[model samples]
Target: MQKMKMIKRGAASVAIALLLLPMADTAHATIVKHYGVDWSKFQGNNGKWGYARDDFSISQIGGYYNGYFIDQSTYGTQVSNTIALNRRAHTYIYAQFSGRNQADQMLDYYLPKVQTPKGSIVMLDVESGNPDTDSVLYALKRVKDAGYTAVLYGYRSFLTSHLDLASIAKQYPLALAEYKDYKVTAEPDYNYFPSFDNVQLFQFTSTYVAGGLDGDVDFTGITENGYKGGNAQAPTTSTPATTTGKQLHQDTHNYTVKSGDTLSAIASRYGMTVNALVTLNGIKNANLIYPGQVLRVADSGQGSTVSQKATTTTTTSTYTIRYGDTLSGIASRYGTSISALASLNGISNPNWIYPGQLLKLSGGSSARTYTVRSGDTLSGIASRLGTSWTALKAKNGLANANLIYPGQTLYY
Candidate 1:
């Protein structure tokens, strides 16, 4: 196995204040765009998930997303990763954590990684019966601190039963979801609309249902209602058949899932829902989606699963992460786990690496921080540092300092 690596740079002034700011970007160039969709397996007779031959040039994708799914504690990584990729859309995503717990890190995780948001707009879920105004406000404050624009995602009854919109509207955008022009499903879910202190993204009606890409997509493009009133807005998405058909026919199946296939953007693209798709595919979570995996268009008429063209290949025994190695290949070469690599060190996910990333399996792990490259170990490091393996492991929280990773730091 290769050693792990760790890189530490001086914090920029902007980074220090990032946590407390609202709507801040994590990456230097990533943009924010809010997106939504009817969310199903198949595109509406008119909508699409993958790129089609006719309307490749433009689209307004919607994913099957809701507050409860977004806000769930078990779904933080799932939500954050989706939000990160969808930083390219221009529609509001109604995110909700599963439970309203103070211990939940939905606000913290999202705020810290704002640079990748597709849409700069944010809408917090205020469950209809939820009375926890303080917790909701805390999440909102984090949004402000991150420097992102804010809105409240709720129906009229939810507001009447639980929220005081007049107060929340004082500072944030209130996304009023008023169901109309609709059919009742599961429960007697109706649209909402009323006078409120603030209103931005109002849903006058939602017949558009993104059925996880498995069933027919309920499209709003042909309808007179949705996001905008009949024939409303500047850049309305046109169905493939009706538009001028200038879009390139890139088969949706061809786009392999690289590290970039975060759930949010794809769900938005096809106007399907995230959780429904995630659940349908049996994905463990959002962060774990990997390259080479062909993402099916949730429904798209039940074809065989994606198949990779078979070729002869040789498997290498093991690897040591070099000073400037990328995680993509190492994870592939060893077929080792990404989470394992992360856990071996105190490394968080997706950060770039630099010199001396000590690879745990190969070696490294002696100091408070050590950049393990190809090979390192507690015994070897301890011997060199003139310390005991027991002492070194204890210094860090390693149950076994022997399990150090490349680029990880040792005690100074």
Candidate 2:
């Protein structure tokens, strides 16, 4: 985790005003929140999820996180991994899809193939090159009509520059991705929060290295079954009845350790004492905590269940600095912090960085099979794999290196 400086971008002023408007009261507590990841083709099975599993209470797996169908052969394998992760970790899992040609195809071609359970989210990943606003809206309508929770994922720039986010923000919850300089900033730029008034999730860092995953700040439990919007509707099965004064229990909520977070700070957030937290989670050394460590913040009654998710051992990778790179420039480019880089590389001074110095980029890469999908290119795969285009082509034995298709297995 890295501290992010919040700088207001152009449209933030108006969005703040919109946020000030009064609305119906909902349950407001630190418990109804979590942090998690959005996966894609580059990542493999849950074992390869690396340090990420330690930091997140929820995960949004993409057969649709990007707009492509996974290779059919491995598609079932991915779904099985998702379910196993959810059950073993007691984590909330949602399904996300990018919108373009695949938006309309989600309810048909994709959903059946993945078999995401009902009541789980089906989010729209809106980024550059997505379809027209009307087309995207219609596609969302189809998702909502299919009995899944519909949500929107886009950055402030993507929404402001590419589409009319205002039109749909009122209709659905917005997951905003807006990154600032994580090395120096302590928190996300509240000033630059998007103008779409219904912001639900804020992705503060794409390069969150604490858990070796993307960092997000979520207000609503989109993964925790707390985002179910009700209407003039019948009572659904197994829905827990709303109870006032339910005992504050560990199973009820959790908090991920963020950059600059201390045990005292987290205890303060949950209205608990430091000793209480330490006792609850069995912390032998309060000062030895690191980023991405999940802390149990609440106490449970006799029936309260405990999570079984354990942190797995992780590996590391190295990246040699290029001539033009500064510590800040490298940190920004790699989604890590200058401090983390310095700590990993054992540099005494953050300012002193040079070419040919190998900095640890992430946890070690695992050998895996990637099934190519529509719109994938060799160059794109190489960038994600941390290898060059020529290396990838040679590894896959491509004569042209320019052409590839869906369902082709390229080993890395």
Candidate 3:
């Protein structure tokens, strides 16, 4: 663990005000491109602390800094050297890991190593494919709670395919790592920007030899002048009105526990993790929800159960098929079974679904189409729409059932 001191440098200026402004209206200022390196590039640079790939000293490489792996356990092997190097370079520290509770622990361990000036970022490298969405969310929340300007870093596809970025995109400035269809001619050309609401930084490539390291561009204009400190106040997050002592009925809101519902199943349906559900609902025991228990399934604020504001508005009973839809996933979302959906739809095969297929909801309304969202599987879509993957594929004329893409539609 490293000891970090927060130092406010210079009189508070307009740049700091701009940095604190909400990102909903970030001006598309001509982004200044910068270059830097991560610990992976430092590996084997020098013998004992050969964790870096290249032996070039920090001052020699130049540009913005995002350094080291925080939760690799073996990261300590290079901590002494990394801290010493960062002290000379004043680089931002990144804490990379995949556990909700581990976020605080790792940040704690790395906090002592931060010798940089105050307001330095402690970005969370959120690339680990942890199925538990809440783990990352809670980890982000934990990072902010610790008074660090927590940023999220991962490739665009990985973020969309594996995690529900929609839940947290607005709150955290995305540090996207996307490498596709571009030659590294000089300053890298980033053709693919993430769909995240706030993109503060873009890491275009890990092979930018110009700086002999990974390449990044700062959109916030903070990194252009070098590392001036930024505060760690919590980012804005959406909070659903709470409902007390009643079952939730909003489409993506409250959920009623069914006979076969487990914490994992219910959490998945609402795009959350089991541990998150437990923490949100304050369940004394994770295995103790009853068949009729209504639980809160959204938001990082308030309790796990909806409060006095739970609504009774009925949602459309049918779901449209989107990319990444899967039979098991659909069933989990709707609190129904794949077999029931297959039987209802008269499908002989369960493994064939396509986009543009409509599916019936649990209430058995006319089949409706659902637009595919990132991280959606046919089964997951089926569960949410109260249909089966076979039914979805058959309705959409999909023979492979396993293939789907975003924006494609499906029927029940």
**Best candidate, TM-score-wise?**
2
Off by over 4 Å in 2: 1-24, 27-31, 47-102, 182-192, 210-212, 226-412
Ten residues in a row with the worst lDDT in model 1?
A: 214-223
After superposing all C-alphas onto the true structure, candidate 3 shows an RMSD in angstroms of: 22.5
Cα lDDT listed for each candidate: 0.38, 0.50, 0.47
Candidate 1 per-residue lDDT, tens place, 1-412, comes to 0111111223334322331244232322222112243222223322333212111111112211322323223222222222222211122233443334531455544444332132244445555334456566666766656545555666766776665556666666665555434552221122223445444444433443332221111111211222123212211333222111111111233223444345554444333455434543556776666655656433221121222221223323334444324554344223344565666555676456554665553233221233333376777777776777886654443443445443333442
lDDT assessment of candidate 1: 0.38
Best model per lDDT: 2
Clashing pairs in 2: 3-185, 4-185, 5-185, 6-189, 64-96, 64-97, 207-335, 249-299, 315-364, 316-364
- When 1 and 2 are scored with TM-score, the better candidate is 2
> What's model 2's overall lDDT?
0.50
1-412 in candidate 3: lDDT tens per residue?
1111111333235333433444443354333333444444244321122123222112111111122332332232222233323311222334444555555555555655532223334466656445346766776665566555556777867778877876667566567776554444234343344435566666656555533445565555433221323111111211111111001212234445544456765665555655456645768898787755767665332123322221233335677765546665566444356786677666577667656777765664333456565567889888877789888865654435566544344555
Show where candidate 3 strays beyond 4 Å: 1-35, 41-99, 181-185, 210-212, 222-412
For candidate 3, the per-residue lDDT at 212 reads 44
User: What TM-score does each of the candidates earn?
Assistant: 0.33, 0.42, 0.37
Give the TM-score comparing model 2 with the true structure, all chains together.
0.42
- Model 3 Cα shift for residue 190 (angstroms): 3.2
